[model samples]
Target: MELYKAAMVLGGVGDALGYRNSRWERCPSGVAILSELKALGGLEGITVSADEWPVSDNTVMHIVTAETLVSDIWSLTDLYREMVKAYVEIVEQIHKRQPDPATIEGCSQLKPDNYLLGWHTPFNKKGSGFGAATKAMCVGMRYWQPEKLDNLVEVSIECGRMTHNHPTGFLGSLCTALFASYAVQRKPVVEWGREMLKVLNAAETYCRKTIRHMAEYQESWFYFETKWQSYLEERGIAQEGQNTPKFPKIYNAEERDQVYREWSSEGVGGRRGHDAPMIAYDALLSVDNNWTELCNHAMFHGGLGGATGSIAGCLYGLLFGMVDVPKGLYLNLEFREKLEELAAKLHKAANEGEAV
Candidate 1:
């Protein structure tokens, strides 16, 4: 129960800190971000409050997903319906959250019953953003039963496709949820990404069977799978800690851009679905037991700091809970109490085999 609370609450804390009222989120330079942190007395001096460090759209959409999951939904249709309704409400608050373009477009095209008819937002090359994955931690929490891996993939991919139809987009959704489920099962963090690749085979088969008619579906999965495999290889090499190259504690803008470019769709770094989660995973794996350093690497990168920090925080919180999180990091976080309530409910629902 406490672990769930940590995941949700720290996710907000990460968003707030990395967002820094949206000042650092788009800065694209880890060096500059570190310098600014030093000026503010570094991480310890920070407080996560709305007026100071408000959670970004990442946490906002995550809340929407969490609320929908805890509703009394009897079937997938009901789940998707509730999601559409919630998204419609969120769209009205655009002036506040600054949602991604794909989200806005997808919500605009949604019909209350469209999902029931097996319809989703059409594929757009540019629609493969990280928004889908960033908001899916609850999807992982909701269907966390390890034996329900297929169910997790089905719902997660469909949820991703509601706004982002590309393989990178939906696959990232599956990856995030899968990792959360593994965390609930107490799986080793080092093996999570590789395990995800094994599951990707099943997910790819499912996608091929369901969306074969879509253009280039096979190529899409191939691209997504290859990228993940490559990342896993890099992680494995790093784990050996032999005479191989090492990643820096804080990357300069150029080095950060290069790393993200390799993972990006075009060159947008953390905005892409795949790279966003990859960045979070990289941050988690690079650290031994340094939570602050993990967060520093997670948030100071040249990518979408809020998205990566939120993902990293969710992963860490799930595995370690709030016990090891810095004291007072979330004391002033906006909606902290509400997030903890939702997390408790979500955790209870997961254990009870029904939404409560």
Candidate 2:
């Protein structure tokens, strides 16, 4: 019954704040799309709801990760740190011209994998459910046992508990981190996308049963008949005790399936939301593609997965090497400055783990 304009807030703030430093060099087309998103937020339309504007799970999730990195203690409950980052986002642009930021926006100190700070699952709240990045914070904090860590799935499961307490949400996180960890690593080492496919397929294999529940995922015909229709039908079909459907060992055997697999709880590309790996996948594939468009799709399609979508979007956009994202949006995405500082801390933590 309520019309939500939070998406517009995210788009507007991202554009306005980012226009200065880290924002992507404006492309005529990208600027146009930015305006479109801005207009959608009630700037032009006679809005029915004003306070209803929510930056959504996308921005909040990013807030958490950005906050976590800057905290004195790497704890998820550190809300104070998060608030600090929210207030001081311009720091991301501090060293932009000096010594050339090793990564995006003078973000030389942070590591790629450690970017995600925390997560939040919907738990049937009818909103973005916790996805991958947040749970990793929760699980990773405990499993500091680097030696025993078997694979990405184990890490994801332990971390997923921070928010997405549900098995379905856990599955999404498992796939996202496993693949992001893999695809990101493969990029500079080997340009070929095939090398990273193993991790993606591996993740899909682990979430096979849940994947089967989605109308499009259970069979090829559903996907062929209608794209988004099947998306709606498969949502929330499984109850607490009904037993979720089984998943598949491979990609959906349908259109452009190989290029991008299912990414959401549906266990397919249509999974909606973000996957850091998917962004890298597309970036590696399309040079002419607009980073803003890719980020928009990842951010907008992601609420079902919540914070995972936001972190995943950042990971993917970041992987494009900073120059990829629109200058206006990246500069003002609520916590860009703290993100760099946080990235440094995360990088230090990661390196400390490696040294030990």
**Number of the predicted model whose TM-score against the real structure is largest:** 1
Alpha carbon lDDT at 214, candidate 1: 57
Tens digits of per-residue lDDT, candidate 2, 1-356, equal 00001221232233232221222222223234345456755222312121222233334343353344335653433432342343234334323321111112112222223345322212321112333333233122222233423444544542332333333344445544443444234333122223323334444454453342234233332221132223223332123332232223331212223223444434433232233334333332332235444444332221221232333443343244444444434333444444454444544454363321
TM-score of each: 0.91, 0.43
Give the distance in Å from residue 173's predicted Cα in candidate 2 to where it truly belongs: 1.7
Worst 10 residues of 1 by lDDT: 237-246
* Candidate 1, 24-141: lDDT as tens digits: 8768777788888899877787766789888888888888888988888888778888888888778767546556677777677667755554335667665678888888888888
Candidate 2, which ten residues in sequence have the lowest lDDT sum? 1-10
Taken over the whole model, the C-alpha lDDT of each candidate is 0.77, 0.33
TM-score of model 1 vs. true structure: 0.91
Which number leads on lDDT?
1
